[model samples]
Target: MARKPTSPADEVLLAAARARSSTVTATQLERWRGAGLLPRNVTRSLGRGRGSTSAPADGVVDLVVWLAQHARPGRRPHDLALHAFGEGLAVPEPTVRAAWRASVQRVVLSGERDLPAPADGEDRTDWAWDVAERAAANAASVVLPRRMRRIDERLAAAGVSWAPSELTQYDRGPAGEEPVTARDFATFAAAGVLAGAPELTGPAMAPHVRALLPVGAVSPVASWLEYPDEPGRDPAEINDGAGLSLLPIGDVREDLLRVIDEAEPHQLRAAWRAAAEMREWALEHCGAVEAELDAGELGDATLAWMMGAILGLPRLLVRQALLDRRPSISTQVSTAVMVLWIGVSLHRLRRLMPDGQYELLPALLPPFLHPLAGIPLKPVGEAAADDAVG
Candidate 1:
């Protein structure tokens, strides 16, 4: 059913929407237009000092119907934008960027927000030091999800191994060369990714990555991750050089927002793919671990995979993602950007290696995740040149 030009545009859209589902209303169209979930009709003036006439663009009625279907009380416009993006709906670019901004702010620490304004003529170094202190304290923000902890306890009882002993012996976290607990190391690593803490780029976090991988055979990605921090070496010669630091002092959120705001549609799609793959990896590993627990024995590989997927890369991605804990589409889309950030970082670290030194393994490498996210991996320089062109 289509509306004739004789009908009012809002009425046409509302009727089309209501035709699909009677719940849609004229007021709903107005509200969604205000929120950017729906676009207003286009208008053109009559030639002879007459008022303009208007009509909704083609297919807006369907979009209106889709928006209404997703609508609910308490849903934010950002949520609608993200959901629209995920579904390939015609949600506006500005709304999607706004959604990305909200997602970035979610993990920002309270200290970053509440810093006292610099006292008149006080050294800016004081503010710098304050930032460094709060950032170092970022590791304290790590929390083993309650459900994951419970699963670990269950597995520990079932003769499945918990966090590897190597984790305790590994040099890890802000405390240099000191052994840290598995959860401690993983927690710090999670924090470090966002904080640009140097400890993460060093040998410290390699063991955690090793423990997290699901591969049953020799994993190649670990070799690069465990690459030594050479003394007095050229900056390009080590992982510390190309590590995940973002400019403007590694405010990843700012860079990530820029990426989203500026990325081409295909790039965004690729990022989404990578995030989905990682999430699947986490789910499959946990499922295997749970199955083993049911059968009364956990595979060593499965245990390691479980820890890596949930604790290693998920970072701020929380909860079991089941029932009430299920993430909203908006949250899911936002978190994908976080994974894209990590994937791009992995790509950067890979560039530190001499050509052919490391193999590309989409199944194992965090860098290849870009391919999963929808980016084709080419030579680093070529990829850079292509991105510049795009």
Candidate 2:
């Protein structure tokens, strides 16, 4: 039998759902709704005993599409909820955090039970669990505050205003462009961002690196040199030496190139692991901040911390993972990739500000030893003195 033709209302609803991305499907939508990552559709009565039809809630389709892009098997539901919140969904903050906390408790309990019987002279399994518990507790206590503080310091130094409303809407640059570089990664690691194993790399390094480049700009050199076009500029005309030099990652190109040239197969695997972990952590942190913002509890202090986390955490994780141990071929390559990832993310955040805002806020500049290397160097002491006199 032939199926009945769809109504115009149904067609409009389907089109609205697909506006963000063309790949959404009924199964994915249902799954997300079941998981509570999306809201239920609104239905109208058809009269008699006939079934009702509904349209997907406003923004729910976009939210579902975004969540699908980041979904992985074995990922916890709370984590998904948090991710949705971080991506600016209207999900309630308390609900997501409550879910996350409960999930964490379950994992902790399962981890305790799953411990294998220790061999002779191996009483450290229990000790390891204890340490893990303590670390989890510490992370819970400090992660949010620490992130907010870091952001605050950076913004203060940069002289950016801290109104919560403005901060929430603060641009993170072009959606596709994220700055990643080796030098920033090295610096972040030295500063102890995520503080994990020297031997292990985050899992998402390769994908992150690939995401930073334009299509066909996959070669190491091309990815490093190519700049995404700025508003009002031609893409082909945007890569002048001076413009390139102005980027923090630009200074680290040689270092990043060398690391990529020397990576071994096993080391690459480790790098991949490290990169994935860093990206995950970043998204998780972003979600937490966004949740708090939604709750109307994001004070200046907290907002600052979040800004810091966004700016610093990726580099910290990547750098520490790469430099924690002796440099091997895999670690080197992983480090190079991770650096690019961090650099790209950082560049994107910097670009999020209106063009002149970045320049006006000096603290937003990359943390370079010779900060003036790319941009014209101004004497801070003179500027301060002038301000004092004024």
Candidate 3:
């Protein structure tokens, strides 16, 4: 049976409740109601069958205030909805979960679609836009796992647990930073190969060249190798004339340089495709990890590996950005932002885990710092000889 409509006096009553309980504004009440976080106001017709005035349901004022206190700034609507559901605010769990998942998926899809294509040249405007898009996408990617983890926390706090409709695992181990080491570099080189990246790998610099060349000299060689033909000059001539004794490793360097120069266009396209795939895969894996955590299927080891993978992605992206001489500025900025997000996430994750239980896997450390690929060590007396020559 339909209930009797409330009177205008009920609005005054709600106003009084709001005054006593919380400082929620009239606008907030309407928004909460529209969002289904609160029940709709009841309306009553005047005895003369004239117009009606609406008043909030009993206790809604206090509930709204309570939600306001818990609500954080900058939260997504779905996050707020889920929070309400977790707090037993009368919204259906399935409905809330579905809405939240759909909102997240939409954001992810938009980021993926909006990822800027490679710029034609040094088009600063286009490059800036691309960087902004990339940063936004990367930021989204970083936040996704944190969001999933928060869902688990919220449900656990509320003493609720539910399995998703589908369950599967996609094992792509930790994606981010690696320790500076030869073995780690090899691992990444292998991964690049498997990804069908161009044969950009080559032998490390000979020991004598590594020892004789100052770190500064070695740095430019790596960059130059990436675009040897850009100067329209022979890399060997450039190195030999510069007296770096790079001749011993000249053949290997030239081969790698040739691959980079000849295959640059393909490599750039490949990097974009690879980066996109990695982002998509990482997001999917986050969902899987969350589900596994709920089911008690995920252990510390697996969790650590997953965290490492997430952390590794930023490094990979940044490396690719740097490798492209005419890189999208957006990609560089986004990669940096992603690294920050990943670092924060990792710190939080570490706090939750047992001491020494989580260790980042040794993998693609930064090129400049990698023992094999990095600048060669200098002999103690070599600097004196070079200084004398200078």
Question: CA lDDT of each candidate?
Answer: 0.56, 0.42, 0.39
Query: Model 2: residues >4 Å from true position, as ranges?
Result: 1-13, 43-55, 92-95, 103-390
TM-score of each: 0.63, 0.27, 0.25
Stretches of candidate 1 exceeding 4 Å from the true structure: 1-8, 42-55, 116-177, 181-248, 270-280, 296-326, 346-359, 365-390
The lowest-lDDT stretch of 10 consecutive residues in candidate 2 is: 191-200
The TM-score of candidate 3 is 0.25
By lDDT, the candidates rank as 1, 2, 3
Task: Give the poorly placed runs of model 3, Cα more than 4 Å off.
Answer: 1-20, 34-36, 43-62, 71-73, 91-98, 106-111, 114-390
Cα lDDT over the full model 1:
0.56
Alpha-carbon error at 229 in model 2, in Å? 62
For model 3, what is the alpha-carbon lDDT of residue 325? 42
Candidate 2, 1-390: lDDT as tens digits: 865565544455457657756565555655665777667666788889897877756766566667657767887666676556544565434445354334323333222355532453245434443434433432322212344344335444444443335433432222244554433233232212111222112222322333322222222212222333254232222233444422222113333443334444333333334444544444455456456555656555344443443343333453244333454333333443654434443344455433534553344322321121123456899879877986
Task: Report the candidate with higher TM-score, 1 versus 3.
Answer: 1
Model 1 clash tally, residue pairs: 4
